[model samples]
Target: MVREFKLPDVGEGLTEAEIVSWLVEPGDTVAEDQPVAEVETDKAVVEVPAPVNGTVKEILAEEGEMVPVGTVIITFDVEGEVPEPEAEAEPEAEPAEPDGKEAADGEPAEPKDVEATSGRVFAAPSARRLARELGVSIEAVDGSGPGGRVTEADVREAAETSAGEEATEEAAADADSGLKSATRKVTDDADEDEPSTDTDGAEAAGAASETVESADRERTLAAPSTRKLAEEKGVDLDAVPTEQTQDGEPFVTDDQVREYAEAQQQAQAADAEAVSGGAEAPAGGPDIEAGGEDERIPYRGIRKTIGKQMERSKYTAPHVTHHDDVDVTRLVETRGRLKEKAEARDTKLTYMPFVVKAIVAALKEYPVLNSQLDEDNEEIVLKGEYNIGVATATDAGLMVPVIKGADRKGMLDIADEMRDLIEKARDRSIAREEMQGGTFSITNFGAIGGEYATPIINYPETAILGLGAIKDRPRVVEREAQGASDGANGEAVSKEVVPRKVMTLSLSIDHRVIDGAEAAQFVNTVKEYLENPELLLLE
Candidate 1:
């Protein structure tokens, strides 16, 4: 039986993706669920998996071609049975030549099919044809593709260096430029669009900088990445033009600097050749192989969802962070005492339960902190009830599973509920509903060993609190002491400073919905409860 593999909806009603590369080609056998192609969407690169085990009968799209969702990307001939489309696939192959031949080169000749089905390309088709006529495999030529997809560019580039473009191709292939090469090309274009401020001796000589003017103009401005790129590329920043905007900001653009530096390097290389009569090639030239093999996977599925949410939260919320430290010694002792009782009551007691309890109390006292900013209504929706979300780190990503009505649950109940939610999250068993509708969120990065972090506010919710690691530290205290000499028959009493457990609490709140004073007060309230865990019972 034959099957057609359609691009399933990656996520979020996304409609199309650009075919970056194919992992398999026609005639290659593949297994079900095996990754066959890498597609690039607007946000990320995604691996497209095969739907069924079969031999590829046809490839419907070319690398760098864009296809709509549900489009047939490949056809499979199961059990060595060729699909009927194999006969029809000729038309698909023949039409591409008449279409792209002109754009690739000035002349139209018999175009060799340049299929990168298995991700190997070595030379330009013309070069390949030339090599084939000369009885050579183009593979002998170095590839400049991401994985060294041998390109006309790489062939021409290699040809210029020496007669042995073959050796350079291997060396270049070993150096893998892929994304770095593409980025460099973009950088070159970007450089022309913007000029760098750091000019070299030639640039300085051309511009004729005076002692008085150069000294006065030094502090005013620069291109964004020009100085940095110049330093990396060995181009002096002072020699490049500063007439580029760094994203509308007054700084330099990376392109402007890089272009200037590249030109300077080329000039310096020529000068070196003239002086040393072909001295060990100048310091830096194209290392088109510096970027390791980069598979361009499309941003789809869970990562795509995360990107949207983060962008929304970052743009929509005016976030403010507040920090405070609390001595958790008393709370630690209280938890130790409550553990047995909690277990007897069928509740697994932990420090988080105490923290959750304290948060519930604080929310009740400061209702505004437990509110959401409703953009549609132009008002703040103060949640009369507490639906606390505990951010759980999962393999998919970070998910906040909420336990609604946290105010109603006792510490033990909260602990049990939290355990269930966390377990479900880790197992990827958390339902969509359970992960949504959170009024507020708390992340315990302290478990991950961080003293402070400015957490991004969970969207719509006003605040998020990050807990830091707890550690023992010296604390000062007053104590009464009696001398042994004062009571010969009695014993001497002494007091001294002691080390106690301390924890840091960092709270990030939406300043638009919460004020600095309110955020500070909330932190102080949480600190007070943490310092004295017994007060949790009063709630």
Candidate 2:
């Protein structure tokens, strides 16, 4: 019995995924729950595990193919059925050949006929596509992949060999034609002017044909976006040098293409300067050639998902940003005091945990900021639980990992769990559930050196707080004089300016649900807790 496995929805309502790679091939035995393939959804990359123990019978989908959910991707022979005997059962060596004339003639068989006589050929889908593009016979190329699977490189090499043979034959045919034309020219004087004209026309036609053939031979391995980049930059993909190779072919990336294009532009600039008597170019000016082309990345995967989410939030909600600076000198001092204690417990503490606690305390006071607007029911749903989402930057894009029951966790616990979630998010190992159920989000652009930014609210959530870089600035402080006294209250006051640590906060809220005054009050509440770090203990 053969069992089929379909692509499942790994993320919430995910309709499709790109097959990144296959870990197992046909005929390979797999265990239950074993990962057979890795797929990239709009959110993250996840492995598809086998449902039961079986030998892989066939892989229906190819790497780089976008497969829809519920589409069968692979088949497994659960009953341990042997398929080798079927090949041996055919009596005639050329089972599919009706005449068997090629065998009788002692000529070698065609590569495609081998598969017809046998069963299916073991080759990657990409290899087959490349073979078709290059006009190479895939069945004729020897595979270099595991289990003797044909790869893209094998097809390219075979195409080169075929092209060389065709070129030789064409040269020979051209030579014979030239010889015949020369002989005819010597025999007939009436058509004397025609020979020179015909020869010139033939030479011109041959040169154009060679140029086309040369362009066709310039092939290199690159992703679709990289290829697009190369085209836009007016740089040939084959001309780009790269240290990476996929399936034994030179693989070009978007960065490599950009570097190559920049080099070309610099070289051209130097050449122009040399020709113009070494005139110095404008300082810090953009090169006209470099500015002509715009870099384009394929809008898909995590980046695309983020774009859609942002668009929805911006268009659906009227966002209002309230910016203010907080005196976190005490908060900084408190974290410094607790830093060593956290490290003693094998934990690295950061200011995020303190900020999270402050935000939770403020949210408790202003429940409206922690609620969602349900337009369908014309009601504002106020959330009772505190699920704080920490917006983390990753190689794929921005990912927010939510901390559940944040109000109940201690500062150290929040630090530990937040660190764990951030690490997992950066490495893309976090599950979907870990990123969901957030009532509010915090984006710390401060970690990257930004002063302040109006962070868009994570959709379905009412508000998001943006933290800016902490810096020491001069602030006013009032103090009572040591010995001087006035008749009233018997005290003398003095004002002084001193340097204090300050952090800018930008709080963006859905204007429909939270009023501007309420938004300002919420930040003020957060500031009060942060200014006196000990007050967070009462939360």
Number of the top candidate by TM-score? 2
> Candidate 1 residues 135-196, lDDT tens each?
33344456544434454334333333333345435534433321122122223244554444
Report every candidate's CA lDDT: 0.65, 0.76
Q: Residue 180 deviation, candidate 2, in Å? A: 33
Q: Ten-residue segment with the worst summed lDDT in candidate 1?
A: 207-216
Listed in order, each prediction's TM-score against the native is 0.50, 0.68
Q: What tens-digit string does per-residue lDDT give for candidate 2 at 145-181?
A: 6667766546655655555455446645654443433
State how far residue 261 of model 2 sits from its true place (Å).
Answer: 20
Q: Give the RMSD in angstroms, all C-alphas superposed, for model 1.
A: 13.7
Shift in Å, residue 449, candidate 1: 1.5
Pairs that collide in candidate 2 are: none
Backbone clashes counted, model 1? 29
